[model samples]
Target: MDNDFSVDLDDILATLRSHDIVIARFVTVHRRLLFDFRSTPLDPPLVAAVDPLPSIEARYRHLRELRPRLGDPPKLVTVFWPRFVASLADTPAWQAVRGRLSASGHPGAVESADAALAGLVDLERAAQREAILGGRAFRTIWSASPSPR
Candidate 1:
């Protein structure tokens, strides 16, 4: 004996149609920036928000390279975000690390590391500004852990 099952082709087609509609809505309403910074002319406010900051991922990578002792990119961002609550430049960890490097007499290491941290803050602010402009309330990179890509 064999069992037969009935198929609801109309139900399946309706579900597919609903998914297509959702996809179309997402594509139209949720446009992402093609580049971190605008290549074409943009609103003055947006230009001011992003143009002053270094490229997000590039800045993140540079910071990671400058501070490999801090651990991986995500870990570094997580650690740095809290320290930035009061001041971007006067992070306690930066002072300690800078002192150690200075004692070791590594020329430019402290300055480069300081610049990288400052740039990381700029990247975070830029991302926040862009998110607000896009009408997005939540974003993945709030901690400034730029995408590895």
Candidate 2:
């Protein structure tokens, strides 16, 4: 696991549980699986790629609305590796979301999130290179390129 891409699963679970949100994990190899979590075997919602504006927005809205009710912020944990570049490149929705996020102005939450995500990509790439040289299985690699905007 990349230190820059660290996510405390236990903390996330506690936060979700505090808000009465059930967390589930599912293992699938399909992009469309993101459309409906229920259709998958995962229990706690897992974050893979930050794409699909409508779907992401809907989920955010749902969690935002649930926050007050649950008395805590909704917890979402996502893990991505170097291969995210190819995977995301193949998805139009992912590209669109990436554009929107990268275009966000500075001095705001969006900017901060964008920076953090970019850092995670860098770390993933480094990890992938290390794995390749070590003769290990291909790991997910995320090529972090700064937005030209």
- Pick the TM-score winner: 1
Which 10 successive residues of model 1 have the least lDDT summed? 20-29
Q: Estimate TM-scores for all models.
A: 0.35, 0.29
Q: Residue-wise lDDT of candidate 1 within 25-50, one digit each (tens)?
A: 11111211111111112211010111
Give the poorly placed runs of model 1, Cα more than 4 Å off.
1-80, 83-88, 135-149
Q: Compare the candidates by lDDT and give the number of the best one.
A: 2
- Write one digit per residue (lDDT tens) for candidate 2, span 25-138: 212211211211111122222223233235545656755453323333334333322234333334443343334434432224334433544544565466567666653555
Could you tell me which residue pairs clash in candidate 1? none
lDDT of each prediction vs. the true structure?
A: 0.33, 0.36
Question: How high is the lDDT of residue 135 in model 2?
Answer: 34
For model 2 the local lDDT of residue 78 reads 35
Error of 2 at 29 (Å): 15
